[model samples]
Target: MKLRKWAMGLLAAGLLTAGLSAGSPREAYAESKQIEVSFSPVHFIFGGEELDPPEGQRAFLYKDSTYVPLRFASYALGKAVDWDPDTYTVTVREPKAEEKVSIDAYIEERKAGDRPILPVDASALQPITIDAYFEKVNYVFGKRTVQPPAELPGIIIDGSLYVPLRFVSESAGNKLEWDGETYAITGVSTAEGAKPYDEIVLEAEQAFQELVSGFTSEFYVLKSEYDGADDAGREEVLLQGARKLLEGQETFRSEILETLKAKLKAGNYYEGAVDQLAAQFEDKKQGVINLVTLFTGKDLTPYLEKAEKELEGK
Candidate 1:
């Protein structure tokens, strides 16, 4: 997507239209477009996959606000959902132990490596709040208005607003914690994060560069092994190293997501170039992975899946 057009189009088409605060910067277009209601095409993506709502629960724009069915969201995220009879409340809970994939061994293994291995700062990624009914004030105005984080936008139940905790954040692997005292959802996130835009661009660039370099080095070794292997040994060593590289590639991608989040901070009008660069970086990396798989003609996916599951808890 063209960064500038995508930003403005979404913002202008009801996803944005932010209201100005009492004493904030006033731009003519922003002021005129406030409360502009327009229909938008929306989709909810979790675990790097897009989800579909049950039959009639398609996402739609109304009153300059986006809305989605609560039940549909919970089901898509693997989160448990319930409704209260008297209190008129809908409840959701995140899985206790969601990902079985372990990061410890990877960390320990990296300690002996030359350059310092930078673990993604999970604390930095903010949770995107979902709601049954949204008050435009929270999402609009000078606040990060570019992207509203409306995966399953707010829905209204009997005039009260509620946000479902399903699919917290795929990019950050965010989790929700219930506070017994306040009865609110909160907790530690297991995803990457960035500080400000400038810092994010710098961090993202560094992380991406390192990942590419690592992939290049591993690819060279894999190619070398493939060239030298006899037919009898080709499937053995060649496929094994290829599988390992794919698994490690996932780790690198996750590590870089935080930097991308910061680099793609919503509502920052001066970041079109950064946005374009980030998207291009993703395409290039994916192209390399595709080529690796195509050249090998070996389905190394099963290995990645097995490692992601059985290798955990070891």
Candidate 2:
């Protein structure tokens, strides 16, 4: 395949150049450093005009710039690339021959019609070599702009470029399920799993409601006392309400902590978990202030004044 040839050629060129270099062979080798390859000029079109390959890939234009790794391009084209390591070769096969169309043609056709061209959906494909696919796509679509570490384990398999499953799955709004015996992921959501994403958002909203409810109840009790509505009786009510509200806040915090702990124990630290927690905390604090204002029927100037000190102690 043209793509595979280009990859092999680049590899061969690097090896050959390194072998012939005199001093500082690593520094002497040019392509040893990361380089870019562009698909736009070679294959992409926008507004009926050919888009240029990105600058980095253009530098390598002298040496088969059009070549793309068969596996990577095939996957991008929504085809599957099967490899036989024993035979040291790859086989590119489309799911259905009736779907035979180059990526450029596919995109152009979509652009000409009412429908938008969605990314190739490869969720159903079986696992293959992720590394090979990664290298191919990274070299092609990535324009070779970044250099993946050479010694990473596992090949980019299936149609989805295999990344750290934890990061990719969570980002894609999917959960990772681990089977101890086989270590396979079975519960991955396809692109169509908008419901899971919606559920997560809804749960977040409910959590905020719980946090605000307690704060609102406490604020009303505090205001009644400030307004001179039987100080002694109101004090007793305020203290009880404050205690309950504080407990509610603590419970919410505990829920967040428990979720984090579970993720950590499961060996999946989601990237956004910390940020989400912090945002929730801030939202709860603001809710408390808003509730206080509503209860007092006046500006919460005194409480806001002491907020900094209270936060410092916290």
Candidate 3:
């Protein structure tokens, strides 16, 4: 690899390119002359939770920039971090819906390793590799592009890439702060906070209660009108109430149930949480159906089914 070009890439765009020496990489590059680096014990807090670095990896000081393990940092921010050995490319992006399980597994799998660091001395310069570019995925634009960070290039120590901590955290929309005395880095994620399961269930119950109260009030008015009307006019009054109930059912299905489902999916909710919420939604819908039957003195099962089918087609 062209060392000058790679060094320039890191300075401007945070891309670190490097050349791999022949034979076993660690052994072959041990004798190369480079800059001196030091290791410091740095603490990391992400999204209100403390994150411990994997064994045998750490944040180190290089020319005043705090360099963190690239994969670990990206994963802490809830992004999918990947390393391609064949192409020597690192990719960072939003995890796909289907990748949630695999990502969790990967995190657990990376908790252990042994990468011995060379002792700091006059002749020791940390082996730096400037031979990788980051490909950032943007799901909103539906594009996969190689977009380097706008600051310093990353360094490769042992087998891992170390990137500037501030750049990674800010790029992920996190508020980062450092404590000089304690040697700690803390960050707050800007992603939407997950709604509690109880809160979601309570909201659903309240909305369903309101719908029931409004429908009952409208039904009473219709009953009063029917009682005063001639037999020919009474039929129309009952039909109006039935139409209103069916419309209310559709709104409850789309607005309340579906909206809740979307919110649950967006957050880091578990599968059991979604299933429980779904059960409550079904209970609420059935209660509405029963209320409609009692008020109109006619079963609305067929009408509700037909309306749902029409909605699905649309």
Candidate 4:
């Protein structure tokens, strides 16, 4: 099939949409309270490891309470944060462990268009405004509406919401301690028998990389054979090589999935991590499809479909 036919299928599935919707605009505020606060050089340690806040974002001190960027802190600690402009509410939730992915990676992917990562210089004490009209804005953790103590009310700086450190840590079911002398804040997850998330991801990713390396070596050998073949002989070489490649693809995919599931059963893997493996697998599959198309001048989709049916029948 032509590529446009595939795109039409995507449209029928609602997998494609027109230009993205611009969300509701924030309400204008006439009454506002301006207050001065000092940005402190406070370090953050989460799950026993220190996380460097994105450059230009800092923890600030106000009324003896320390405030950090709302989305940054929540995300680093494996929580989800969302803002609803229509209701002026910020909701943070501890998504189930199995559903949790590395939010840090997700943030990096969307950093270019996100708000919290926007450029700012919060190196010293600066004046910030609290719009009276936004006083009724809600902060929710799970299903509970969080009413921060008057001494530590939420503040906005440079278009980013800032919430008290203690509030964020405890809400995410983590314990927090401040080292006044060192200007460091350490947060430890309070969940019993919680696995080390970063360590698990590192181990799984290393194994996946090794698999890809081996597959790449085999792929190059097949490419060499195909290139050296004459026009008439190329089809036979491609067909024979494609069988081995497809078999290896299925085998590697099954092995990697099994390993990932084992880790998940041990409470150490997030389901979303599987996407990394799937993406790499699909890239290799597409490369094989492209090579077939280049040599035969025909759509490989039907051949791939026939191969699928054969494999299924077997």
Compare the candidates by lDDT and give the number of the best one: 4
lDDT of 1 by residue, 33-143 (tens): 122222233434434344444343344444423444444444444444434322323344433443212222222322222332233343443333332323332221111
Candidate 1 whole-model C-alpha lDDT, 0 to 1: 0.41
Pairwise TM-score winner, candidates 3 and 4:
4
Worst 10 residues of 4 by lDDT: 13-22
Error of 2 at 272 (Å): 1.8
| Tens digit of per-residue lDDT, candidate 4, span 150-245 | 667666544445678787765444556777665667765544575544445456666766766675576567667877889767665555555656
Using TM-score as the yardstick, the better of models 1 and 2 is: 2
Instruction: Pick out the ten consecutive residues of candidate 3 with the lowest summed lDDT.
Output: 21-30
RMSD of each: 20.5, 18.6, 17.2, 20.0
Models 1 onward score TM values of 0.31, 0.32, 0.39, 0.44
Better of 3 and 4 by lDDT: 4
Q: Candidate 1 versus the native: TM-score?
A: 0.31
Is candidate 2 or 4 superior in TM-score? 4
Query: Which is the leading candidate under TM-score?
Result: 4
Model 4 ranges off by over 4 Å: 1-22, 26-31, 96-99, 106-135, 193-314
Which of the two candidates, 2 or 4, achieves a greater lDDT against the reference?
4
Q: Which TM-score value belongs to model 4? A: 0.44
Cα lDDT of model 2 by residue, 89-201, tens digit: 23333345544444445434333233333343333323221123323322211111222235431132221222232322343233444433322223332343223332343
User: Which stretches of model 2 miss by more than 4 angstroms?
Assistant: 1-205, 214-228, 260-269, 297-314
Clash totals for all models, in order? Answer: 9, 11, 7, 0
